[model samples]
Target chain A: MEIREIIISLFYLIASFLFIFGIKRLSSPATARMGNIYSAIGMLIAVVATLLNKNIVSFEYILLGIVVGSAIGAYMALKVAMTDMPQMVGLLNGFGGGASAFVALSEFYQKIGPDVAPDIKAAVAISISLLIGSVTFTGSLIAFGKLQGIVTGKVVKFPLQNQLNILLILALITLIVLAVIYPQEQIYYLTIIGISLLVGVLLVLPIGGADMPVAISLLNSYSGMAAAATGFVIDNNMLIIAGSLVGASGIILTNIMCKAMNRSLMNVLLGGWDNTASSSAVSGGKDVVIKSVDSEEAASIFDAASSVIVVPGYGMAVAQAQHAVKELMDVLEKRGISVKFAVHPVAGRMPGHMNILLAESNVPYDKLYALEDINDDFKTTDVSLVIGANDVVNPAARSNPESPIYGMPILNVDYSRTVIVVKRSMAAGYAGIDNDLFGLDNTFMYFGDAKDAITKLNNELKNM
Target chain B: MSDLFFMVYVFVLAGFVGFELINKVPPTLHTPLMSGSNAISGITIVGALVASGALHATEHATLATVLGVFAVAFATINVVGGYLVTDRMLKMFKKKK
Candidate 1:
């Protein structure tokens, strides 16, 4: 009935609109900055609305909460390097889960009397929040540990890990039953949280370092659901809606991200046979020796090529060589030669790794195609330029039964008449496996920074 | 029934339809999107918001209050950081077609 309440509510509406617009702009890497602004404005609105609410037990703590949170966030946004984004994400995700579970537990304890309606609702909200929150928290910390190399990123499959995890799941189910029947039962509450935490750890153990990005996305989705569940318990329509939107979008992102890597959800969640074999891929003996080439000598091939396909990988991103690579593409295109970029499903630190690199260089979208679409075409191509790509292009995926990426699809760069691999060294990819294609007869290894190598290739091509 | 579950429903479906916008979105924005979403996903603060006064006996209330502070603090970090990062990332593009 209050005018200010209505106005505050409208403000949230505006914020929601901004969120939509932000997500839309985010559709294009070019427009992503705008999207962030829109979403932030929406959040700003939501915050102001929360402050405006009459139900607050106190204001100082709330304001303090806002100030402290924003300070750290601002630093991360401005100070953290782009390469460290995954780690930053893991840390932030862990914090989110921690917050949600805390809220749920607090609410449950603060309102457990049979007479208080608010406490009852709070108790219910925190229960679900605690369950999902614990999972997100531990899972993200493990992801961070893996990325930071604090823990071995190899899939940790302890004996009976699966069976132990199943028992934890059963314990969680029992706790849920107790929560519904007894409602205020504290023992059930604590046990549920513990089981959930265990579930989180177990869930991520089998996933190798290669799948960190997908796991991060999935945990992010879980965090959102935890938030939305909290919103529902509180009867906060805006929180529920916003939480759900993020939850939904995060899941979509994880799935899309996984597909780009040609990984299935079941495989990722269950930590199946696909990634567990990562240990074997790390050879005890230097199994295959690979030869390397300097930029100058490699340039000769580029100068003579009629058609070239640039295959991108994580190295291109780590070195930030998109512009230089694009320069190479431009010159090659001008010389009456066809230049197309071949993107592997699971290239770079995450999915869309190659696409991101190319998009940054302002490469046209039409010029890029997935491995399946372009593999057949590689055989007819005059030259294949492999730029820092590793696992995605590994021929082992095609023939080796013992290889980890086997049965998984790959880019057919080997089929090309001439294959040029540009890498710093003949080191293994993220999967830590030796690339057999590195020593193949048709493959010429161009050893240097991808940007420098591509730029030199451009220089040599122009001279011709 | 509530909008939260419905939104979750949308996200779940979107998760499966991962093929759609991902291919459509470019790398220029993917990093920003990832960080932004990570930040937004911090909305888990709602848990603490409800926890502030949600306990039974006086002892339970005291415990809930202590935990509630952390819940709110953590959620605040997630929401504020998520929104601002996403916004800042989006703001880099001053012009739109």
Candidate 2:
């Protein structure tokens, strides 16, 4: 190898190290920013090294591409609100997958000819890359659409949706076989891309809005798999390493998300559109009895509380209530009441969604506890304040067997001595099930926007 | 190992490393982790560069070039946007004074 080649290899080695080191730092909040910096530097080094390599014949197109890409990326990074992080991640993941598919498509187009027969192995790799990448690209866009409300948030079910999905997969498999056999035919490749794109839309459409967290994580994994396939097509070791790492980590995250919902991977994949509220199996909910309280009265209860646990959900995100929640926590803390945040794994639109929002609100890291850690404390707590959360804190998950979310693990807010719920209405949650907790004697419903209610409560406590 | 087997070996080992590495990440960082990994997936730009920049312009070069430009642009978007967003998010988690 030439000296330049050796230097490039060394650069790549350095880049890989930085990537791994950066990811390691992400394990802790204190070091995550440094991790992001390390990874960005690594990406920059890799891009620069690839550009300087002898293989790139011209810099014009590459430079133009970089400038355009950087402008858009910077605009999005700077302008997107923290609340829209899930959609932003979805769009970026889609772009990554789309880019991989295009690379594979171009490579195949460049190599195949009427008289030429591409190597079978390379053909297989390229086909896999194109298929997986296309699916991820379109699927992620659908996810983004759902999150952004551009598409319907309800589960879109056609008469033969699952059957059609299976047919699309079968047709794709047949095309792959044909592509491998007749390497000179471009028609098969085009059809495969078209079919995969359609399949991507079909795959995500049946998932309900409530399942966006699982769908987003699954799409993240698919994007990684697509990149891995692209790496195999191009015979790039670094791409393979990075792609597989992403692919594995994404799968693990997906599993964690699924476990949080008590759902299986196959169930999510096959479009488990769970509308949990329609089934009125909660025999305990028939004799509707609810204790409704105003913010002033709730404040009095909070003031008397020795220990308080705050449970936040998607409603909190919609109301942009994290800051109010933080203020409430502070007020309680000043009064010598211990306040802890009980976070469910699938609490928000995506994995760790609540954590980022709470962090953005400047909540202390030490006060936030995962479901398992804070669950037991709810039983002994003087006040359990549920902010815009229903199903996750519902006793239905533990008591009602026929309910859609019966087996799913939930925050045991009902066990607390006094349960205060801040909600927009007594509407059922995404699971569509009425929360019996609202009807419990110990639970007091404080109706209003979560942010407004919490702020009111905070003021009430202050004046007292 | 043969070339095919070597690639498989790399893939398997890398996957194990990934699983092990991610296990330590707290739930709080899962969003940043997803965004960060999305940026890494942008490595497809290498393939894009090769596809677009042929040593000599040929009959199919125009098509390849156009596709390559798009590939590079999109991949860069992932890399740049993903990392910056992740950094911005991580910054929020800092301990309050």
Candidate 3:
């Protein structure tokens, strides 16, 4: 009703508009960078408006928090390698969730009084915030640790893993109901927080590193839901709108990742690869024949090729081979060979991860094609150069029903006229299944690290 | 009750808008989209600012301030680090002639 309150409300409205506009611009690469800047400006306006609120009585702590946080954030933004992006994003998601929990906690503390019972609505909101926020906080940290190699990347499953998660959910619901009935009872709220944290860890711990993309995406969604819950606790529309927007984006990405792997969301969440043993057993018994090639020999194939498609995987990331791959593309392109990158949806640790790495190497955005767009082209292509990718390009996903990765969509590099795979050895991919593509008659294995092998091949090409 | 209904309305509408907009983003920009949206979720910093600054002379004032300060710092990191990292990634996507 007051003039000042109306002004702040109007500012929030404008900020929301900017956020919507920014995300809309992100639909195209040409405008995506500017979109990010637009969102940042919106954030600035919201923060300033919040500072202007009459409820805020002090500034010292706020200033201190901002300065310290900004320093660390700037350092991480500048220092993180492109390959470690999944981990960085996971860590950031954890912080956002943790912050939401903390905000809810502070709100609870402010209202804590022996004689005073919080309103039922506020109580429910606070409890929801604590539960979702704590879960996202701890869940994202575990996901981060898995990707950062601080925790084992293997699928760590215990007996009754899914049952235990279900039990935890049941308990959380009971606790939430208790908190609502006895709004003054801090015990119920605190217990909810603890159990939620435990559930977060347990939920993510069983997921293997290969499935971290989906986990991170899901956790990203949780973080937004947490923020929205905090918004409900604080009765802030800006938080609600922004949080829901993020929640929706994360869900869309998670769905895309699950579809790419041909798995359901619940299957991924319940810890995939339960049939790894049986599937690998089926493929392991056979000694498939493979044709090996040296860098010079591979170069000759490239020299004769008119069109080439490059399929990059996590191995390419581990070898830091994006730049080298870019170099190879250049050499091939110079010889009048058309070179394009075929990036599978689940190609790297996260969604669109391979694209980011390739982009970092100055690969033209227009030249990098998604799986669907380039899958058919491989059939007519002269040489399909696979760089450190295994499961994604494996033919087993299509032809073998007994394989663990069966039915998953894969790049049809096996259909190319000549399939050239650059890898360290015959090691299986993250799924631990043998790749039938490697043994195909048209496929030639170029052994070595992705970077070293690509560099050598470039040398051979230049000398010729 | 009316206010609650209003907030719910806004939340549902915003979610729909998000879905429509995100569905349009090319797979090429998915990573940036994730990080950028992650930064926007840091809008909780507004709540954190109020929590930290609106301290009264209550018994739990110190405790609340500590929690608020941590919340502000964490949310700030999400916003600043997320946006900066996203920009770093987006800057790499170039079109060659």
Candidate 4:
């Protein structure tokens, strides 16, 4: 082996190790940033090694790609609000799939002559990469659009959507087989690519906004597999290793995300189109209507409370109230009042969303409590300060079987002696359903920006 | 290391890099996803597959071809299996309430 080759291989080994460590670190919401940095370095190493290799024809394109990619990446890192992270992820997944698809198409373009080898091996690999990559690219883009609210995520459920998708997939497969046999038929592959791209749009079309995260994760996994298939096409070792790594990781993430909501993967994918709530499930929905509390009144609740449990939800994320909340927590703690964070299993849209937001504000890890740990305490607690929270604290999940969120666990904040809900309005969560917790007798709504409310409360407490 | 190996390395390395980007995103379920992906990334058995068929100096061309076919089959299984499981997991989150 050449010296450079040895160096590159060593780079691969080292990079792979970082990926392992980075992934391990990511398991905790705390070290996830460091994990990401390590993985980034590993990728940098791998890219450098690939550039060192002889057959790239033009390394300058790789450099050009890097300059463009890094600029976009850095801008996203700096400019993207934490609230837009899911949409950003969806867009990035699209780029990955598109890149892989382009690479496969380029390879096919280069080898389309009459004498291009009978090497069905290369043909099959490239075809698989192209098909999945094109589909992933389009599907991920659609998911991003929906997440960003640029497009509605309403189910455009047609008369035969599933059947159409199956037919499209089969047609693409058949075209690939014909392309493999003909070897010179460029049109067949092009047709397959076009059809696959359409199929991608169709895949995400029926999926609504609520499931965008899952759609994004699944597309991320597809992008990984597409890369792996490209690895096979070109006989590239790094491609296989790196692609499989991502492909596998994306899959695992998708599953855990699913479980967090207490739904089977199949139920999430195929069963969520129909309305999850029925009218009978919610009785006298306003039996315990909560009146919105102002800053001064909310202050009184804070001052009187012996213990305050802050239950964060997606609304807090939208308002970026984490730091303000953290500041409020410190003030309460200093005042000899107990402050604990109640984090539900499926709080926010994803797993550990609350933890990440709080961690970003440098909240103490010890102050955080999972739903089960904090649920019982709320019954006796003086005040449950639900910040921009919704479905996670709903009582319907606990009692209403016909409800969409039935069987899904909640924060049980209703049990608290006094429940203060902070939100902009009575808008539902990502599930687009109303929360019954707002109607509880013990609950009081605080209508306004969560950060502003917290700030007002802090000022009032300081005066006291 | 031949050019072939270098290309493969780049492909896989890109994989790891993307992994970091995704990992760093402030998603709710990084750990379980990480654990799940680690189990799937172990399917890099695709490397072993190619190695088995590509390095046989004494074998006839036909035998080499057969081994190559098997290698492709095994690697494809790894690819298909890995992707399918990941797809299934992602689909799990679609039922958001």
Top lDDT model:
3
lDDT of 1 by residue, B1-97 (tens): 4654665564455343333444456544555666676666565554454454233354566687778767777777676666655554344333212
- Report the C-alpha lDDT of model 1 over A222-274, residue by residue, as the tens digit: 77677667665656655555566567666776876666555688777666444
Q: Mind giving the per-residue lDDT tens digits that candidate 4 earns over B1-97?
A: 3655566566656656655655554344442343234323323232323322333333233343343333333233333332233222222221111
lDDT of 3 at A301: 97
lDDT of every predicted structure (CA atoms) = 0.69, 0.85, 0.91, 0.64
Off by over 4 Å in 1: A1-9, A113-124, A260-263, A272-291, A318-340, A353-381, A396-407, A424-436, A448-464, B1-29, B44-65, B87-97
Candidates sorted on TM-score, descending: 3, 2, 1, 4
Q: Candidate 2 residues A1-464, lDDT tens each?
A: 99988887788778877878888888888888888899889888887787778878887888788889889988998899888999999999899899999998888877865566568888888889999999999999999999999988887777877788889999999999999998878899889999999999998888887788888888888888888888888887778888888898889999998888888877776666355435465544386788789988998998788999999899999999999999988899999999889999888888888888999999977778988888888779999989878879888789878777778999999999999999888777776777888888898999999988999988999999
- What is the descending DockQ order? 3, 2, 1, 4
iRMSD for each candidate structure, in the order shown:
4.5, 1.3, 0.9, 13.3
Candidate 3 residue A179 C-alpha distance from true site, Å: 1.1
Candidate 4 has an lDDT of 0.64
Q: Please give, as one word, the docking class of candidate 3.
A: high
Could you tell me the lDDT of residue A212 within candidate 4?
A: 57
Model 4 residue runs over 4 Å out of place are A1-7, A28-34, A153-156, A270-273, A284-288, A349-351, A430-434, B1-97
The best candidate in terms of DockQ: 3
- Chain A of candidate 2 scores what in TM-score? 0.97
Model 2 DockQ reads: 0.76
Computed on C-alphas against the true complex, the DockQ of each candidate is: 0.37, 0.76, 0.86, 0.08
